[model samples]
Target: MDEVVRRDVEHAHGDTRMISALAAPRRTSAGPAVLLLHDAFGLSDDMLRIAHDLARLGFPVLAADVWGDRTLPTTQEEIGPLIGSMVSNRSRWTARLDAALAAAADQPEVDPEQVVALGYCFGGSSALELLRTGGRLRGAVSIHGGLDLLEPDADWSAADPEAHVLVCTGADDPMATAEHRAALESGLRRAGVDWEIDLYSDTRHAFTSPHAKNSPTPDAVAYHPRSAARSWAATTRFLTELFPTVRPVEH
Candidate 1:
């Protein structure tokens, strides 16, 4: 049996206490490592499940904590402040993500050269930010994340030529406006970056997460199983091409 294990890899979350940064469940296979960033929901059970799922795919996943081990926000009102703090100070949070990536690469099972950063909603954007600002990743996958930047937009001329990006976004996602997609498309193209953006019609924000549907804007964020499956399929193909050392296990 390819049993997936979870262990708390020590990573500083801007404090003395060791936070959960690595979750690499190894068997006999190896491919690319995944550095996962959580959404505003803050390292919930759903996030851990994602790590286990990735482990089954023959990939080691390091699900990083954006906020140091803290109680999950009960309401969006609480969530807003948490996310706002990170976005407002992008440099500090991005540094935290950088640290997590370093930890992921240091794992015995992970190939440092083949590490990929992935995120959902807030996490998706965070992954993109890491790559945009010189985080050495083979690829970055963003699932339903708003691409609008609080900082100045990325100068594609400076991007790493080998870095690839996959964006799975809902056509009707209010937060991820068409303007934002257009701008991102323009930048990736101008920079000569290998990137693909898949727009899922009739889908809204957080299509991959059932828990997001309960947010304040229910109409703007609903779970779309079809889109979720499709996006994951795309991600699987993209990652396989980027890191084809191991075959994915049966889902």
Candidate 2:
């Protein structure tokens, strides 16, 4: 597989800021576009690997750095203060996601109408938040994200009724509790949204990452290889089904 160099994208609001993106153009040019959002730890090498893997599946994948040249917190001690301060402020976070999508859609190799958003960890949760604002995304996949079904202002009427959704999470992830999963499913059912949720038994957060390690205590983090592989396969199937034009290309 060929790798494309990272390009500078201007993220806008009142000020213009630049972010790096990795784009892999498809050989056929007829496939859909997939936007890969990295976890809160930021755009590490593993995220780039995932982008390449998705691109090899026949879609033009864009891996965006939502942090946008900013320093990301690495240790567990730093995560709480950083995310806790930013989580509730959806406006700032979703703007970053929106900018990434807008830039991806503008690419010559991308089909704007056939864009799919897939996120990992913090990104996974943000992908769903993007949906709340009524973006042009055709589908969304959340992988082991911290999800809550308590959107008081979610206008189910305005959402794309046919839009597909995939939630691939770990059964043992403390962040994604069974109650929350059930609530999400119930909310989707009530809204008549087309969605599927798969839980991997014994898998913790960030299972897909090879560097995944389990937390020793009840509130720590852990990863499961089996769960990660299975969830990835499920995500591939879901994306292919949603966008029939994109087919998996063996590497």
Candidate 3:
């Protein structure tokens, strides 16, 4: 595995604040890059680990802190309200997400033209928002993220054809139910966007988070190792398809 170098940097869009973690393979030339968005709970250890893992795979990964410098929500009780606040102000949230993407693309070790936006849960929906809003991205990936379009009536006729999308989610995830998936698919299709969705059966919300197993709402959110591994493998494959010139580090 390649040694990963990482750092925290401040970023923002207007008044919305952000603290992003940037990670990349040491001693290697810059190749592709990914803008990683955290879940509703904020940028957790698991999120950082995934960023490093992707960095080791030869991509410069930037994990954006949507919550700014505020204390991260550690419990379900705290998480809902924090996420709700951000979601309520959809425009501001989207602008902050764009700022994160721009910051990642501006990194010295990132190939600006090959940058992609990726997110988990709340962040996942943000990735799709980038595409819906016509951000200049090679692709976008959503991991166990919400699928509903925040602004259902917003125009998507001008969506970029170059921006491919991949969504991985638990089949039984209450947050991303079958109805939600259908609605998202319909919207994407109507916009003529290139996209694919992978559903892991028997899995629920937060299936990719190791910490989910310890959550009080086990039935709604819990880690499933098999689903997590499968989703990750699919994500890498999706990335490879989009950025074929970028090679993974050999073990």
Q: How large is the C-alpha RMSD of every model relative to the true structure?
A: 2.3, 2.7, 2.1
For candidate 2, write residues 1-251 as lDDT tens digits.
Answer: 44443454555533536364655644546458788888877767788788777767777877777766644557768666556645666676667778888888877778888888898988787777666566678888899877752353454554466677899988878778888787677666666679889988777777776546644553436767778888888988988787777665654
lDDT for model 3, on a 0 to 1 scale? 0.81
Q: Give the whole-model CA lDDT for all candidates, comma-separated.
A: 0.80, 0.72, 0.81
Q: What's the lDDT for residue 86 in model 1?
A: 74
Alpha-carbon runs more than 4 Å astray in model 1 = 16-18, 28-30, 149-152, 214-216, 249-251
Ranked by TM-score from best down, the candidates are 3, 1, 2
Q: In terms of lDDT, which candidate is strongest?
A: 3
Candidate 3 error regions (>4 Å):
27-29, 148-154
Quote each prediction's TM-score: 0.91, 0.86, 0.92
Collision pairs in model 3 = none
| Per-residue lDDT of candidate 1, residues 1-251 (tens digit) | 44666787877756623366455554654457898888878778888888887778778888887777644676778988878877888778777788888878777778888888899998998988888777889889999986764243657665577899999999999888888898888878877789999999999999999786666676799888999999999988887888777655554
